[model samples]
Target: MSTQTSRLSPEKVWLGITPTLWWNDDFINIDIGIPFEQCISEMALAGYVGCSVGHKYPTDRKTLKAALDLRGLRVSEPWVSTYFTIAAMRKQTIQKVRQQLAFLQEMEGGSEDPRKADLVVAEFGHAVNPLPVALFPNCPNLTDGQWDQLLDGLHDIGRIAKEEGRRLCYHPHLGTGVMAAEAIDRLMENTETSLVHLLLDTGHLAAAGVDPLAVTKRYASRIKHIHLKDIRADVVARIHADGLSFESAIEAGIFTVPGDGSITTFPQILTELAEVGFAGWLVIEAEQAPAKANPLQYAKMARAYLRETLGW
Candidate 1:
């Protein structure tokens, strides 16, 4: 009997990181005011080929393209906060999707590469991540009606994504409606596979008390993008014990780059992804205070660790 083998190749799976290393989207006080040029240049300096959009990224396509092309980096995906559960915000959410797709397409500059950028989306209708409230035992649960709204809105955006040659990858985020494993199950079971796919975030899953490897196994086919993050177990324990808010947890140094934290299932996760023939971006998205963690330093650390782990 003959069998085909699948592995993660440097050529196929690109390594990238979000600028969250330099700045925090949820808590701007964590930012160090790193200029856009330095932020992206350091990404390339760290041996990354791509990055997601950040708050500091210019909104102009030409300007953004010029800066990134200079560093040999490209945009991987951009996070979109979709208010699908809110009836009044639905139109605005779809508009945001369309705008982001247009921006992403223009960023490619009509490249012939078949790979399209992903839309990292999550429901933010009642998210507490931006608030000072506790994350656990505080995030609101979606009602049956809200679930229907969210799923229906996801399908709508998914179709839009397909039409635009992009993929809608739903990100199950902490302090959101779909943070829990059960909520993720509902999302996977209810959404149309063709329209909606998963953006697997390791840190978020781990922080929510869900096994990231189990999530990878169960939703292997549906997962189209990845956020390779690690978490500080000590900080997580404090959060649970003190009912710390999501923003507070982040400020308290709950998240870190892989190989720098307590999560030990990454090797198995990578092996499972390889076995499943997953070929895409593995983005290091450790949300930390830039001043304390040192963005470029941690970026280089993550790059070194990944090189060691993957033998690239």
Candidate 2:
């Protein structure tokens, strides 16, 4: 994952970490029994000053702020899953989004703050990521009708989020209906730019067999958030050939922190960001088992790599 690139200023490219490294919510057995305090403290010690909300964190503003502020960390974003393939889930999704937006807005404590976090969402429509291997190859692709439903719902939700003084960044995650490059193209082509934005994740893009920097160039204007991750490309290939579930692939160590993986395009991605004057959270999100890779050590390694490469 080594790359040689020019650096962006510290203020322009804020570094953050996702708590998935410390305590994975999807597969509890892999969490290594790390407490919330320990996780945040370790992140601070590892040189990260911001993070996205995870399952272990408090949802309430005051309690959450107190814990994070104590550790010199601020919230960057939060993931929200939306099942937009059906009509019934649409109302529930919006209601939930409104609640989330309200919480983030309240945290900002003003009409609009540049530091306010965007709401990151992934379409959880018939996602077969954690299911058995049989379901992985058979993962549902969005039908024309479903695409209509999704794009309309996204436009509505994204517009409303904007009206509420927040941004909505769509995350095209693996095992979802919109993981492929063609699907992402359709999404960007259909969705309103003023509302829906992109959350470009490096590892997910590579795992999906898509070139991450190409996506960055194609959708530079719409990218509102970034998730800098790395992939063991060989492991990813084997997972696809063997028909492994996302969970199984993760457990097999298919992902890792940047500078510890095979992603050589990392520097090019950073150069693209620098060229665009992009200024947002560069979240280090490597969803790997903590039992094998100590979260604190991995976090420190990533921090040191970024500092050396970006000269922050």
Candidate 3:
């Protein structure tokens, strides 16, 4: 037998873990509770190649770098989990975008920690559906004008990221303005490759009634970041029946570790990404019940599955 290994680029297969794993009652949880250094150490100890800092984690350069150095982990990406809005209120949207960019700049300047690196990803839009009722009651089905506004905001954000020597990725999440497959397509169509990049989240794509692998293949060229979130179909069904919120569903166990879910097409997804020569950080965003499951343990298992099953 030939001993040739999968020849994907090393950069393409950077495994990352989100600090959301450490969100617990003890950690002061939301974003700031978990000590920055601990976050880096935990991620590194869990076998992740990098760490993606969420909104709650410390964004200061000094703190981030110190943690990275302590844990010997790299900053895979910094996620602006919030900031984009698909509302009709142009002024509010603009304000949010400006504030987001400002935050990014602040973090960059404050990145005194070797591990607190660049803001590599900027997600735009949310998953709030039932248009005209949910978050954007005034604007159901993101109008052309609203889309233009979002695009403008992304353009500005992208400019800042580029100048700061970072990459800007747009995440199309479930229950947000760009929830459906067509909506993602539309947004991608409207966006220029140079202005923004795609953060392919498999779980959100599946939750939104789209084939995650299909969308991944379709937008393979635009994707730069990846969130490997797995979901439980039964819990998802219950959430649908009860009209429960996404956050609630997460609380109720609508998602779990990669190997513990109903998502069975992992090999295919890995194959497709490999075929397309798509290389980027593969982040394990296992949003399971914190009370029942330990995030660090689950994350470690997910990393094992990715390596064994996906050969990543």
Best by lDDT: 1
- Estimate the TM-score of every prediction: 0.96, 0.94, 0.79
Give per-residue CA lDDT, model 2, range 114-229, as digits (tens).
Answer: 56688899889788885765434867798999999999989999988899767899998888898999999999999888999999999998888889999998997788788888
Residue 233's lDDT in candidate 2:
81
Q: Is candidate 2 or candidate 3 better by TM-score?
A: 2
**What lDDT does candidate 3 reach at residue 90?**
46
Error of 1 at 224 (Å): 0.7
What stretches of model 2 exceed 4 Å from their correct place? 1-7, 111-113, 134-136
TM-score of the candidate numbered 2?
A: 0.94
Q: lDDT (0-100) at residue 165 of candidate 1?
A: 80
Specify the highest-TM-score model's number.
1
Q: Please, what are the lDDT tens digits per residue for candidate 3 over residues 256-277?
A: 7677788777666766667767
Candidate 2 — which pairs collide? none
Could you report the Cα RMSD, in angstroms, for every candidate shown?
2.3, 2.2, 4.9
Candidate 2 positional error at 36, Å: 0.2
Q: Model 3: number of clashes?
A: 21
By lDDT, the better pick of 2 and 3 is 2
Q: Specify the poorest-scoring 10-residue window by lDDT in model 3.
A: 130-139
Query: Could you give candidate 1's per-residue lDDT for residues 157-222 as a string of tens digits?
Result: 999999988889999999999999999999999989999999999999999999999999899888
